[model samples]
Target chain A: MKLLESGVVSENRKHIISFIILAATLLLVFPLVFDIFRLNLVAKYLSLAFAAVGLVICWGHGGILSLGQGVFWGLGGYCLAAFLKLEAAVNIANEAGTDQIKALTTVGLPDFMDWNQITELPYIWYPFKSFPITLICVLIVPGIVAFIIGLAIFKRRVSGVYFAIITQALCWIMEILFVTRQGWTGGINGITDLRTCLGWDIRTQAAQYTLYFLTAGLLLAVILFSKKILSSKLGQLLVAIRDMEDRVRFSGYDVSNFKIFSFCLAAMISAVGGALFVLNVGFMSPKLVTIAPSIYMVIFCALGGRESLIGVVYGTLIVCFGRTYFSEQFPELWMFLMGGIFIVVTVACPKGLAGLFESHGAKALAFLKKFLKIENLASKDKKEVEA
Target chain B: MSSTDYALYIENLTVSFDGFKAVDDVSIYVEKGTVHVVIGPNGAGKTTLLDLVCGKTKPTAGKIKFDDYDLTTMHEQDIVQAGVGRKFQTPSIYPSLTVFENLEVSYPKGRGVWGALGFKRDQEVIDRIHEVADMIYLSDKLQTPGELLSHGQKQWLEIGMLLIADLQMILLDEPVAGMSVVERKQTADLLRKISQNRSILVIEHDMNFVREIAHRVNVMHQGKVIAEGSMETVEKNEKVIEVYLGH
Candidate 1:
């Protein structure tokens, strides 16, 4: 414990300490200081932070600035929303085949219910008839998609700015495809009218609180999980693959496998966050998959300090909470304000908000070490004289 | 297997990139436990030979047979598993990982994505890590980040990482390129100690470094091995003198 403290905590405990304090403060009663609507808004922003931390791993450490994580987030959200939407349609149906017929009609079923030949929904859609399927698809759908994507991209050695451009292209292309294709993905309107998640009635205040707390719990788990990954042997390979790939190859490692691991993990984390996001908001749409939202995800990660977990959360909260204050008054100024911060961070700080906080004391430590060296030299000289 | 039965046998090996032959029609063989150094002036394709052996680049044509197995078609990682460890011109240890962790990373099955996450190093593996670290005189820096080390220390750590793989053959590409004289001497000594029981091939631009480490030197020019013999014999060869040793 002492060794760990001297190595890690002694340098700076402020970020971790401040995070605990803020979490405690929120647990105390933002519920009392603010209304349920406001609390839900706070919950939503934190959920975004969970996803951004996932970005930090791939973009910051792995040297892959992924812009298509929004796709995973969208997948998770829609999978859950689809299952939930499917469940809604099933329960609200009066006749056996009519609801099924109406859904097909909604997709181009034909003139009348009599024309419908199929009595049952697709086999794959059957499990979604239950609430559990809705809940699990939130993670499983994105997990599968990310696994496939990671396999293809990493196998091809797509990395650096080229990888970033490809991922960003993926984000915009997916958004366009989703917007245009009304048959499969429901067009720009997206999957809406989600009344509940699992068995929880989302319309009630109790359910809202349940989701609010779930978001908080999920964020904490992801923060700890990301920290563990970044500190592990897997993390060492990821960074090695980033900084000196050719060298890593000579050292007998399969660099592609490590890249795939990081990509897949990042995808799963974002997927979970996205699912939690839709639960609190009761919506999923093509608007969520656009380049703008992907860019916003990057903005929050940059603001938070790409290297620091807590910084990402703080940056997410600041941008999201601050938006409400600016949306009504100087809506035009909001983007510019963020743009200016990005420029300053990229040019001056380069480490983001956490870097800004820790650098103050980091400089002092560097000075102290220098002073200690001189002291040690003087002591050695005195010992020689005594000898 | 007999020495004549092939530790390494390359036949009609040819490699090119964008129509330029990096390695063209190169073939060589090594007996087990032999220390062979490849030497040449700049652009002689010595590094390319090592790259081909280590599977860093694929050949356009030919066979690289190690023992009974053909190595020309193998993946870089599989070639590594087939007992070929490469140390590059620059130190390539993980700058973020401690020396022990860096060594642990290359410890055979301690790699791979799934295995790396769930498998903790066994005591035997950990002890081997210590042994390698001690051999490289990096015991003090076991807990220190590779980035925090001096240039010589990084070199030693890279070697230590390779040593933990316990391969039958090692390929070192310009291993003493960026080291101090004292560090160079130590690396020569370390290579001598390891080469007693393993087949070792090294690429060197320096005749002096090759002399210090080579049991026999093979001088390469234009992607082909031109002359092979004892250091003194190769240095005195007319072809080698006219092409590589002109300076």
Candidate 2:
């Protein structure tokens, strides 16, 4: 309580403002920042950033290390894709002047979809036809899923590695569900050939940029929102819960409610990011939502500096950029290099690349001196390299 | 306090872990604005009893009342909101949070999911935090990270946090377990000041520290109150002597 009165908030505000300034400037130049191919790639990176921000809240701030944020991301993507596929079918039927109600959209209803006897579009598919509700549903579907999952896990007082495992299971389960439910989801193939999203010609660069800028804006908003929480009482409480939840509960703060709230918020953020991602990419599949990519998100957070939002984005951009730029150039060696980088980070620069540039890094270095004298001796050489 | 003003009441409340009753059918009353110390030998359930009262542990049986609420049915957080704050034997401050942010977490209701996500300090709460910080002698270290503080300072920060929450009753588990001599003295004085307006249930091992501040002491052995009275009276009780002071 006494802590906030002094100067923490002001310092945090400066960091946030500068970050906004940096993000705004970048958004303005996104068209020219990279070529169209790379820009599309950046769009994917933006989605990854969105998902990582949720991780920061759940794992970094609240101490629930969810290795499965990809579940929420995948859910959002699938919900949006589902509507688009239905809308495409309806549009094709309408264009063909065949409201016969019984005309099949595709072969054998894909798999789970009932094709033969269905003449009219299901009422459930009606709301999705309207862009506004579809938009709302995009956010709601994942939000509801995260809420229910968080309610169950947090209520029982689950924490630490156990919480991480459950979230992983959640992602794995979702991927399996999506893959198995081929009729509804298009299964392993996923719904594709989407030319329009929300009545906009997604093929147009303006539309692409509109979605891109929106993604950037959302990421900024989330960063600011998280910054506020992280600076205030909730942030402190969250950190306390992470360090020692029993102490916080005894302190009368209701650790469970806070955990659930943070978890759900993280999920919602991942959902938003996921929806934006599919809209930009024009496709999504079970492959994108699988455990490998989910764990890759965790690795990005680790590489970026788990505690810093800026770091997460930075990590995503760097790694995603590498996977894109280096894969074609050195396909044989790309994965090996990525794995090596993670090893180097985990074993060597564990403060993450971001810490190297932070002010407290010197103090952190000092703290490390207590255990690692060799690092102390090598600082001058590293500084020369950095310089 | 008068009979009507009793701060907390417990009746045969018991808790068991793996078939062992850690807190066995215990009932006690704490007077308002008094410093009541619970003293017991190690593993005598001193902590488990505090946990039960604070809603950190659910009892296996019985009834406990706080202010006007049923303790057994209450959530840990609502119990906190019901005007009870707790301080653990260990310093529970977030090492990464500054002393001020640590204090802010003690605010009762700012945790609105939306509000909490973008919160700033209210001027009044900030002023109250300053007052408590000065009282606890933590004003100078307001910006210091909790992990950087000495053990004594960390203890003060935790107590300082509970004070800001302004609970009607505070459950302190061994508040002086690891304090240095000077810090211990400061804590004793701080407790005296806090208890002037609120009931304090302090669990402690150091008899001298207990005698310094406790208006009354409750002794426990094997999960039941053996004797209850002032330090001097409990010190002379035959059962208390056999369980704690003797041998």
Candidate 3:
């Protein structure tokens, strides 16, 4: 017998269908409706959504608000950027021919490095030359960093506002370091003018569309994976820790390991998003890895429902799109409008847009059922109302 | 010193905050398969002694051995993994989770990262949850959010959480602090029933409840064990009377 038909459709089946519909809309409907330019913009936003999703788990659910998520995102972004920059440099080196390459001395260097008067590739950028190594670093670097942070803080029982403050400070430190180390990190401008990934021209319109679909596919997979984690016994443990850490510790569970796991998982996911952001946007910069952006990442998760995974995705898209539109349209009032939304969301709707939908979604469904004249639906709702 | 005879052994455990000693020179031993109760006045450091035993609070000077392992320097979770469970003074349950989930997370099946991710609610887990729910008088309230349970039920649920795992030593701090008369009586009976195989260290103040369940009672006063014997004997001890019962 089908599980949905076993009279348990209201909870599990409804959620599955909603997730499926969301995936379809992102994968199919958006591409069909929006032009390549708009779709590409969406891909960029979706990459940011990855960070927000991490916040949904780490901050929203686990109750560990890391204001330094941008540090991980930047690490992942830089790893990919360094590889692509090297690849572009290699292509330039080959095109210049052996004699010209010798004369130029900057033939093997990325243009920014050459402009900065670097004679040889730095030791740090050497590992990024290999795609496999860069790929591994994209996930591992962030995961290890998060693990270390989780260990230091969680083990010592540092949490809540203090953890948030520390993370924010870390984000600031990363931004300053990246910006000041001009020869290594390309300074304020960041690594830009990326032409290809491996040999394929990522700059072309067709490639942008392809990357959009890839981003969409990856986002859906990540959402499904997160759903699985949230449904598992581990997810419950996280919530238990969030509610009562000491109680959980005394219950025979290693609470810090769970916290570290969640932190690393969130970091790895954000790292993936960072990689995709570089692919879609064709640039990596200190701007994206600063304290302001990190806080914005958390705001996206807050606006999406912290407890609701799908709600977080929708929240990211809405906030990102709203930011562009509001900034472009009302330039001066954008920050004010954003501040107002934050206040309203926090005070009036603490659960964000998802909470708003939940309160009225059932009524809307019932109204739809009545309008469509679906047999037995309105009657059941009416009976429930009477009761 | 022979760990086989005592499930838990503590010698000269002392914890001081600044110049003041919260738990000073407190020595205790619990025999396997017996319910040992610690009765004291409000500031007699009953909770602190339990804290020292469970590794929640580090001792300034002491040796705490559980079975054959030294626990004074171990982590709280490590101490727990060594088969010790602690219930706090107030009901410290996951309020948002259902009573079943609250117990299931502590079921000791998937204690590690991968184990928890792939943990299944098999027949054994289901059977255990049902058994524990019934034991706590929460069989009908399995689906209820833990926060919504009555004061007595929440207390029982916290104790039920401790039983979900495989534990040899259980420490309960004020297990029936705010319970009604009937709930307290029921709890006294429940403790006696659960203590058949495991060693229990309970910090309690109610003398009547202590007399009802304690196989051996220790009266503490001013961070010291004033008397230790059967409930009848300890009640008659002049020092215990002067420091605790007289008050």
Candidate 4:
């Protein structure tokens, strides 16, 4: 009892400390350090952190690697973007003169639909018409999609590189669907010109600030919730499954159900990130839903330490910042530079930043302790001579 | 023997890998509360028979009845849940988890995803862990990670995991293959202790260990059981001596 209690207390303390540092950095530090434009960009990157965090749970802990996280993110972004686009259309129609409205061809349809000769809103777009339904779809749509995908794949016992390839293929399919279906989807351009959400001018600096905090807040909540799971028996079982799948199966666990749960949870979390990405950026695009971004999200988790939730957050921030800075400074060389960094980080620190910290951080602490002991000895000698 | 008197009844069990029958037409009955050991030369299909009974591998033609459940048609986990536990040849404990956690994870409760998430480390779980840990002689090493354990301890830890699940029958694949002499003795004692109220089916090569624990012995040669009796009686059998014991 004593051993268990002490273990729980220490574990809780470590989690508490990490949570405080992350919460302060996201909620306090970033807001104070960066201007609104940069802060908005941080919010965008933090939105992707949701996907990284999900990867930590699914790929890192559960040992199920998914390369199509962007699909769920895109689904979420498109869900909210659809709603906002409709609202923007209504706003445009209300503010337009009779001649301008007639020129639009459809009074309250998104401009892309009007341009594509889509006379009426499609049935799929009907759910996005209501904010409450859109909110539910943002979570459920991606959740159900993930659930179905997980059930099909995991139940069949398809895993490892095969699962990763299947998810990558899913991203490719989504990208094509979003690109070719111009009337229903925004087609390559995506659902842009998303000016308002529930009559609130989300484009305003004040709204941007609010969205940034909201994103940070939600991301922190997700981290905490994931921590709860990791500390639970379910988390231990995932680790056990990863180690010896046969043993866990023989231990009477269905195994696939846990895998499905992790995958669905990851998809839902990624979808939430997607919704925030739409709100913060004021647009949702097929570009963000493609293979490259999905792979990049995986790299974010990998580079941060796939196993470390807070480390992935830092990993996302660093990579996103590096991308923005490099792209601005050396547009031609940034891709290579980013690639080089990823290779170096992964090769040098295979456990990612968290592993680096664990190994070197302990050594550094030991050195600090030794240095402090020497200082204390010197102070004691001086005090004795004075006495 | 009447089927009701036996804890495990495997009949006409045959498994083939591309026309190569690993376990062919084997029938064995393990009486309740008894230790049944299958001893054989290498490639004699002793392990395959255990795999068939535990649902790790489906038999090409056979029926394995564990109490009232049809083990042949059940999933590996379902077989386990139906009070059958299997230990692999190697120590297959979770290396990252502590010994206590290894045992705790195998405890019968919270097998589902949500149940696991909400599973509390309650007094009952803790008490059971301690109880099993002591039984396996790993009480002091409960907090140690499984990887840190010596080879013998890892095997015992795996056994403890099976025991904590309150299984009625255990399928052991060479429980003491890599143990030191002392560990082998302790394991012999541990097996005898655990088999008090339950049935144990073991695949073993160590004759002395088998002699120490097996209530009944079956000697197999080329996917067929050649002899069945006590160690002394099996040693006296002509076919067992010619094929396996080789004077």
**Which model scores highest in DockQ?**
4
Counted clashes in each candidate structure: 1, 8, 0, 0
Rank by lDDT, highest first. Answer: 4, 3, 2, 1
A1-387 in candidate 1: lDDT tens per residue? 233234554334444666686577556566668788999998888767767888878877776778888888887777777676765555445334665656654332212111334343545555566667666777677777777877888788878788878888888888888777554556788877777655567868898887888888778778877877776667767777777787677666788878777777777788887788778888789889768778788888887788777788888887787777676667889767766767887788778887787767445644565677876755654443233
State interface RMSD in Å for all models: 2.2, 2.9, 2.9, 0.9
Residue B142 C-alpha lDDT in model 2? 80
Stretches > 4 Å off in candidate 4: A366-387
| lDDT tens readout by residue for model 1, B1-247 | 4423766777778889899887778767776777788888888888888888888778899888876667778888878888888888877778877777788777776567777676665778777887888889887667788789998888888877778888888888788887888888998999988888788888888678788878878788887778988999998999999997987
Which digits, one per residue and each the tens of the lDDT, describe model 3 over residues A258-344? 988999999999999999999999999999998888888888878888877888888888888889889999999998888888888
Error of 1 at A24 (Å): 2.6
What tens digits encode model 4's per-residue C-alpha lDDT throughout A1-387?
Answer: 666566666656656877798899888898999999999999999999999999999999999999999999999999999999999988888898657797646888899998798999999999999999999999999999999999999999999999999999999999999999999998999989888889999999999999999999999999989988987999999999888999999999999999999999999999999999999998989989989999999999889999999999999999999999999999999999999999999899999998898678645655675677876756554443233
Pick out the ten consecutive residues of candidate 4 chain A with the lowest summed lDDT.
Answer: A378-387
lDDT of 1 at B173: 79
Model 3 chain B TM at 0.97
Clashing pairs in 1: A304-A311
Best by lDDT: 4
TM-score of each: 0.87, 0.87, 0.95, 0.96
| Clashing residue pairs in candidate 3 (N, C-alpha, C atoms within 3 angstroms) | none
Q: How far is candidate 1 from the true structure (C-alpha RMSD, Å)?
A: 5.9
Query: What digit string (tens of lDDT, one per residue) describes model 4 on residues B1-247?
Result: 6565689998888999999999989999998999999999999998888888888889999888987898999999999999999999999999999998899899999999989999999888889999999999999888789999999999999989999999999999999999999999999999999899999999999999999999999999899988898888998898898888884
